[model samples]
Target chain A: MAGKRGGNLNWFYLLLTVVVLTGVGLMVYGQVGRGKTRAGKASMAPVNLAAMAEPDLIKAARGVNRGAESARVEVMVFSDYQCPACAYFATNIEPQIVKEFVETGKIRLIAQDFPLGGSHIYGFLAARAARCAEDQGKFWEYHHQLLALQNAWAYSRVPPVETFQSYAVDLGLDAAKFNGCLNSDAHADLVTANYQLGQQAGVTGTPTVFIDGRQSLGPNDWDVLKAEIERALGL
Target chain B: MTAAPADHAPGPPANRMGIALLALIGLMIAGYMAAYMLGLLGAIICGTGGCETVQQSPWAVFLGIPVPFLGVVGYGVMLGTALLGLQPRFLADRRIAAVLLAGAVAGFGFSAYLTWLEAAVIHAWCRWCLASAGIATLLLGCAIPEVKKLRRS
Candidate 1:
């Protein structure tokens, strides 16, 4: 009787193992397939253009401005350095926009900080770090560095102040001044001010953008952003 | 639940079964987190908490592999060892006891480190992660005496 029971248990074990392996394999394959399709199609999360209200720029604060002042289309961007979508925009799309629209004297780009608070532990500190770099007139360089190395420090088990300082040192900024600025909360108010600006504009997420201070766009894909810019330029 | 082989030092089969049960519980918790990491699950039902924040953090991955995946592997090994040790043929084998004990120790240490990270570094608590750590500690407790009995023989 014991022998017969063991024989039956062996079949059960083998069947269970096979089922578990097959289920896990299919789930992984499906996720990978969907990820590839999304990337290949360049499809982005949709935004409701009609629901986007014009943010009151007059009451909101702004950050560093890039491009020609005479540019007719002013693109105001609210972003968080620790946000993945915002990182994608900064790393992949923003440079292209700069080359085409900003350089061509068609648009002025303004960057505003919007740390998502509890969701991103390092977002506000990262914003302050960027502003500290701005003290040496290297805000854009530091901003790019932050997004590029986001994976390195964003989930760190320690406060990433030293890593932020290293970026400043690499950018040839005064290390002591940068460290002092970061540690002393020199730019904390500026970051807070920008956060308030985002809130007052009804911004609920990172990477939110407004064109000509009237039209809002969650520009996740370059094609969509470019088309919107071209339309704004009457192209 | 068969009787221990006569040559063995008579470690209770119940302890081995308990270890296996704890390991299975740990595996389920870790597997759920792994599913979330893989994007198969939309959101963790952590109830207005920091599960998303903690799981999305950099510490959630270790050397390019997701930490929860590592948890799944660790618990799976422990479960396998415990099940095999329970078999009549393997009851006398000290190697099975050693492997289960080693796995439990490793899991406990890793879970403790993650718990510390949540409290001190990430400043957020993931209930699933906390539960896994608790289970790992229990597994370690169950394995120690079994290994000791095996060693005495």
Candidate 2:
């Protein structure tokens, strides 16, 4: 009887300790990590241009392009439309580049599609939709729409192609033409080519940018990107 | 608080195997979620980048909260049931065994589904998630015979 009592007492202490430790640990860690995550500030990999010698500007890829064909500086971005990091770059950083460099004719900005496989359900579809929208001379508008309305349809269990069409309609694109292009998979080859180009450039992550031929070390901040552009342009 | 008197026979050896298995599963999932929720980027088990990708994916969340946190809650309840039944008088309770069995089945089913998604949809395997799946499966194995033993008693 004494032995049994001892065993029961041991079990009680062990369980008590485990429960208390779990509760306290959760509180501490939860408090620490919550703020950073909520701020939508996950760490971005720094752009690394140290490996290769820079190259002179090449003509932009065959997809949606902005700026002049003969621009001296080319900034090509490899991106997954469904990736949050890519969205962050598009919303916060790309605008600055466009305003300061792309629109001013100092640089030609090109977007290459590299929709991440698997978990990103609508990546390919969204890229395809943007290609279709591009067919009507509204490529940049459609690209912005996808990144802008990402929260609406990016996570849907089913493809959000209809939402893409609605965005096209909002842009005053020819709705019938857009639908035909989408249905026919008119730009399947284009999307595939973009992805293949990205892979060839050793892009393993989204929002990987190349200025001339040098890859971006980290393009999340505006000043860093500006400096990179200046260095590439020898300005 | 309800410690039995020294004269008790300790209630049929206390179903130690079943109790320990539940406790193990509960602790592992709790630790994994707590670490992740605390902002640890890499999975508690293993990750070459796959873990972070899986965690950041839409499937990782349910509604607005992370899904592993829900697994913690489920495991907590299962652990509570096992801890309560450790009392000498309740050690052989058929009701407790039945609840444990049900919890095991449910846990296993959910774990199985998530594992499948990781392979087919997510295209990345989080080792921690795989660990949870394994623990849930082992707990189910422990639970079936436990239910039988308590019922026979």
Candidate 3:
């Protein structure tokens, strides 16, 4: 009886082992072959830049807040939309600074593009998209939309030209004009100019803010920023 | 008259093989955990926040679960199975050893896929991830011979 049981047990183990090994082989093959499908799907999306406009920021960009200016210090922020830390700073820190400084006319915020090439594939496109929105007087609105969708861009294998357009559409932008602005090489030059300027200013990474030409090394909270602004202005 | 057969009969060679496999797995788990922790610390010190970038990437979450957390659970399960095999009271059936070997093979295959993604897609290598892959490969390689032995018996 014991001899019979041992023989049966051996057969069972051999069969199970084969099955497991086969399953693993199939999984590895599938992963390598099918992983590129996601990238293909992303590439097929339409590239419409007009879909990214925001009404509130568009109006402000067109000089509606021109009369509300406060301080004389110009704050130039060199940023990449696909950068997560930049997104965090834009959401958590930029708002307060804008409300207290930019909105109050104490500072004029100038956004400069500085896309990192290695990690963020669509970073340059997003920067160009923001500039395209600028032509329609919706620069700030488009900026916020790009930063808010940073994660979407970072993980996307294909460039997110279409995604940027969707943001313009949500903001009620003119589709034809937005598309024209996006496709034109005009904005590309502007993005390149910003990149050159950023490099010349010794900016090495995204979210490198220059308050009157002095670099803010990292994402500084509101208090440190406020102090910097005051000191820069000799107030 | 011949000496009586030794009382212990040196338990089956299969049991000894199982213990060795388990010890190898434990070593792998420890090596990988240490590498991951060190990589994270380096990223933090550099101020580039590369660690967050690597961690938040879609590859970091396989099937919506954190990979590191999954690794921890997998190692624990493997350790338990090894301990069960080591106990002398329970018969060290070849079938049980085969099943465990199969699991190790599956884990090795998955680790290979992850390593490919790290190189081709993510373009950033996490030293710890590489260490895990290496360990999984070694464990599977050693288990294959044991599996063959179980089959012949």
Candidate 4:
């Protein structure tokens, strides 16, 4: 009788293993593939990033202007350094945009801080750090370093302050000035000001791009963005 | 219910070593969970730097609370059952061993799911997370034979 019961139990164990393995395998595969796409695809409604009634050059703050201030077409970017989608845009697409229109002096790019406080761990600190770097005349270089190495330090439970310092050192900024600025929260107000500006503009997520004060489509795909920029430039 | 089968007399008792292992695993999970909630993980576990990534990801939470809190509860249940199995009164109940086996198997399945999540979705490896999975698997293995040795009463 014991032998008979043992035989039955073996079949049950075998069946359970097969079922569990099959269910888990499919779920993991599906979720992993989906995680790569950005949240930008879900919404196409162009955003103003501030609550102004009209697109005005006076009201829209172009804080970190990357191109000549006199450039005809101005592109404003509301972004969080710690955001995966924003990192994707900065690392892959922004370089090409810089090369084509920005470098040619046909366009001006404004980078505004819009750190999403809820999902990101180091978003606010990274924003302040970048602003500190900006004070020393190396904002874009520091921004590039942070976005390029998003995987390296974003996961830290504590703010990766030392990593930011290392970046400042690498960029050849005056360590005393940079460290003093970073430690004292010198750019905290600037970061907050940008975030408040974003809130007033009713911005929902990062990488919200505006062309000539008008919200454009998205930064996910290059061709759509290029056409939008071309239209703004009357090219 | 039928009487105890002539072929088996409840064997001896559930292996005590397995019970102790369950308790140790429970404590380990609790320790890791405390560090996670208190934001002290980096000072301790920084082997591959993957633990930080895995712990801070948005998926680390379930309904706004860290998922490791759930692991703590599961481990507590495991510890309770294992400790209970030490007494004659607890083992006297025919269903007690069965319950222990069921609990361990359920814990094993859950741990396996999380392992897959770390590997595929998170794209990071946490040594402590892997240790919990290994412990759960061992507990399940220990429970199976102990359940088999029970009489068909």
Lowest lDDT 10-residue stretch of candidate 4 chain B: B39-48
Ranked candidates, highest TM-score first: 1, 2, 3, 4
Error of 2 at A23 (Å): 20
Predict model 3's lDDT versus the native. 0.61
**For candidate 2, lDDT tens digit of each residue in B1-153?**
475666765443344445555555566665666576555632121113566556656678877867777777777777777766565566667887788888888989988988887887666787778888887887787677666656677
Q: Estimate each model's TM-score.
A: 0.62, 0.60, 0.59, 0.53
- What does DockQ give for each predicted structure? 0.14, 0.13, 0.05, 0.05
DockQ of the two-chain complex in candidate 3: 0.05
Q: Model 3: how far is B104 from its true place, Å?
A: 3.4
Task: Write one digit per residue (lDDT tens) for candidate 4, span A119-209.
Answer: 4657889998898889889999999899888867876656789999999999999888888888886767667777777666656666777
In model 3, the Cα lDDT at residue A140 comes to 83
Number of clashes found in candidate 2:
7
Error of 2 at A235 (Å): 13
| Candidate 3 per-residue C-alpha lDDT over B27-72 given as tens digits, one digit per residue, 9 for 90 to 100 | 4444344344434212111113344456546677778667776676
Instruction: For residues B1-153, write the lDDT of model 4, one tens digit per residue.
Output: 466676754432435346445545555565555555554421111112556456655666767767788777677776666555554455545566776777778878988887887776666777878888888888887777656535643
Per-residue lDDT of A104 in model 2: 85
Residues A6-30 of candidate 1 have per-residue lDDT tens digits of 2223543454466567657766786
Task: Put the candidates in DockQ order, highest first.
Answer: 1, 2, 4, 3
- Stretches > 4 Å off in candidate 1: A1-58, A63-78, A82-110, A118-122, A132-137, A149-190, A200-235, B1-12, B38-58, B86-88
Which portions of model 2 miss their true places by more than 4 Å?
Answer: A1-75, A84-109, A118-122, A148-161, A184-186, A210-235, B1-39, B42-54, B57-59, B76-106, B112-130, B145-153
Best by TM-score: 1
Name the better of 1 and 2 by TM-score. 1
lDDT tens digits, residues B53-92, model 1? 5786678999899999998899888888877876766765
Prediction 3 TM-score vs. true: 0.59
